[model samples]
Structures are given as structure tokens and as C-alpha cells.
Target: MQETAYAKINLALHVRSRREDGYHELETLFAFVDRGDTLLAKRAEQDQLQVVGEFGGALDDPFGNIVMQALGSLPRPDGLAITLEKSLPVAAGLGGGSADAGALFRLVERAQGLPDDWRQRAAKLGADVPACVESVTCVGRGTGTDLEPIDSDLTGTPVLLVNPRVPLATGPVFKAWDDKDRGPMPEGTAREIAEAGRNDLRDPAISQCPVIAEVLAALGKSEAWKVEMSGSGATCFALFNDVEARDAAARAMPSDWWQMAGLLR
Candidate 1:
């Protein structure tokens, strides 16, 4: 079986409260984009995984991956060989790891009856895993596991994603957050999902990785409808009403930064 591990982009993330457990309570709008990694699975004599693509080599240990951990959580798992096309930037606040893990979780559940406590299982893998499993626009809260599906349609919304080759780890971004101004959620039709959007993590993330500021600055000047950092840092996006305008903006973007333009998926 094969599945696309679409990148999870935070339309708006507001850090609300930090718990005694060190988990931050947040309110954010999550959306999946067409541009991301892909996964393929096939039954094999022994379980294995091979990584490839732009950021494949970023992982230090392939066999001891989250995919393997997902399989281990299954009951009497059979041998399977998996291939991951790591197209998305690793540790760049794209939720690449959680997307991969969620895809595998679905694969195992489809082949074998899913566990009763699937949400809990997904949450165990990572805070974003449950959201990734849903694979749609959701209001994420409570360390990002409490998901409430919402109506969203970016149909012809053009998007240009620009990532300065720097990876911003989530830990530092949270640590740098002032934990103030945990704003209210955005409200609007599906077409204008981010009309009231705000990302509290943006400033802190930019503080951690200064290059991210440069990216946002470039995107801001593009004359797009709106431009903001997606999750934490590095990967900032400019939204346009149409593809023609988005493509033109992409063409004008810096060549050194990673750039891709497509309709919001």
C-alpha cells in the first residue's frame, strides 16, 4: 500500500498555557499541504525501512525509526518493508516525523484491526501524530492532541512555501516563547481559514533561527494576501488568491531558499 505523508502546516498557532508536565497548551489551525513526503509499504520476510529523497539522510538511525515503533505497537506484527520519500525538510516544524508515523499507524490498522485506543496510541507517538492521522483541517489544542475537525476549503488558494535551509527544533522554540498573548482562534468561512490567524511561535522561532526572519521578510514584501511562518520557524509561506500570482512570486523568491508553489491542498 502507498500513502502520501502530506506536510502539516500551522495556519495559526497560539501558545495558550504551559502545564506542570512541561507540555504547552495551544490553539492552532492545522492544514495538510500537497507538498510532502510519501510512504510505500509491502509485506516482506522481515521488517525494514529504506529512506530516500532530499532529506533522507537526515535521520541518524533508520531501523530504529518511529515507523518501526509504530509497528511494534501493533499486535503480532508481520514483516513489512517500507520506503520513505523524505521530501519535506526534517525538524523544520513541518511535522514530517509525525506524518510518517501516522501513515504507518493507518497502514497497520487497515491491515490488522485498529486498536481500540487509537487516539491514545497516536498521541503516544507524538503530540502531532493524532492531528496528522486526521489529515485535514482541525483546531488543535492541549499540546496539539485535542483535535476538533472543522470545515475548511482553500480550493484555489495559492501558496508559496519558502524554507531557508535551516532546521528549527521545536524544543527551543517553545522555550523561547514568552507564553503571553495566547490569543483567540480565527473565525471565518472555509475559504478564509486564516483571516484571523496568528502564530505565537513565529517570533520565538525566528529568535531561535534568525534566518527565518529573513524568509518572512522576503515573503512579506511579495504583495501576497498574507504571509506568515507555518509552524515554528524556517518554512514561511505567502498566500495568494490565485496560482498565477503565486507562481510569479515563487519565481521572484531567492534561489538559495527552498521554494515550492501550489494551491492549498
Candidate 2:
């Protein structure tokens, strides 16, 4: 079986407060793009994984990869061989790993079924795993595990993702946060919320990787209805009104930078 690990982007992220558990209280809008890493799998006597593609080298330790952990967490009568095609950059705040694991979960689900405690198992893997399992637009809260599904207004909107070829880890960016409450997400449709809302991590991320600002600036030059940094850093996205405009913006981006254009899922 094969699955596409849909790319995740935060339409808007708000850091509510730092919890005693060391996780931040967050309110964010999660959206997925139609493009991302690809995972191919088949039944095997023992579980195995092979990583290949542009960003595959960064996740060379197969056993340590989240995809393996996701496989170990589930129950299967037979093992499976998973080949992960790493198209997305590592640590770019695109939820690349979580999306891969989620794709694996879906593949397992289709072949067999998920346990009743699937959500708990997914949360243990990563905060974003639960959301990525569904890969739909929703509102996430409390460390991004508490999810509330929303009727997204921005579905099918053309989007362009750009990266500065720099990997910014999530830890340092969170540490740099001012720790001020930015208030809750505004009440409105997905597009409306995205327009009025903001990514609280943008400034902190820019402090770690200044090129993020340049990416946002470049996307801002487009005719996008909304342009903002996704999740923590490095990868910023612009939501355009049409595919032609988005494609034009993609071509105009710096040749040295990496970019992908697709419609929102």
C-alpha cells in the first residue's frame, strides 16, 4: 500500500501559556496541503524501514525515526516494510515527521484497524500526531493534542510554501518566546480566523533564523489573501486566490530557496 503524508501548516498559532508539564498551552489552526512525503509499505516477516529522498539523510537512523515508533505502537499479526520518501525538509516546522507517522497509522488502519486508545497512542508519539492522523483543518489546543474540528472556509485554496534551506529546531524557538499570552483564536470562519489571527512563534523563530523574515517578505509580495509563517520557523506559506497566481509567485521566489505550490486540503 502507498500513502501520501500530507504536509501540515499552521494557519495561525497562539501560545497561551507555559504549563508545569513543560508543554505550552496553545491555540492554533491546523491545515494540510495536498503535497508532502510519500510512504510505500508491504507485509513482511519483520518490521523494517528505509528512508530515501532529498531530506532522507537527516532521518537516517531508521530505528529512531517516528515512523518506526508509530509501527511499534500498533498491533499487527505480521510485520511491514515501510519505505519513506522524505520530500519535505527536516525541522522546518512543517510537521514532516508527524505527517509520515500519521500516514503509516492510516495504512495500518486500512489493512487492519486502530485500537480504541489510538488517540492516546498517537499523542504519545507526538503532539501533532493526533491531528495529522486526521489531516484535516481543525483547531488544536492544550499542547496541540486537544482537537476541535472546524468547517474550514479555506479548503481548496491555492497555497505556496517556501523555505530558506535552513533547519530551525522547535526547542530554541519556543524558548525564545516572550511568554506573553496572545489571547485566544478569534471567532470566525477559517479564512477569517487566519486573516485576523497571527503566529506567536514568528518573531521568536525569526530571532533564531532571520531568513524566515525574508521568506515572509517574499511571499508578501504575492497576491495572496494571507501570508504567514507556519508553525515555528523556516517554512512560511502564502494562500493565493488562484493556482495561476500561486504558480507565478513560486517561480518568482529566489532560485536558491526551496518551494512547493499546491491547493489546501
- Please report, in order, the local distance difference test score of every candidate based on alpha carbons: 0.81, 0.94
The alpha-carbon lDDT assigned to residue 141 of candidate 2 equals 93
Question: What TM-score fits each model?
Answer: 0.94, 0.99
CA displacement after TM-score superposition, residue 6 of candidate 2 (Å): 0.4
Off by over 4 Å in 2: none
- Candidate 2 per-residue C-alpha lDDT over 49-72 given as tens digits, one digit per residue, 9 for 90 to 100: 999999999997999999999999
Task: Choose the strongest candidate by TM-score.
Answer: 2
Model 1 TM-score, 2 decimals: 0.94
Residues 133-250 of candidate 1 have per-residue lDDT tens digits of: 7678788888899998787777456788889989888888899988686667767765465866788888898788888888888887776887889887779888887777888888
Sequence-dependent TM-score of model 2: 0.99
For residue 1, model 1's alpha carbon misses the true position, in angstroms, by 1.7
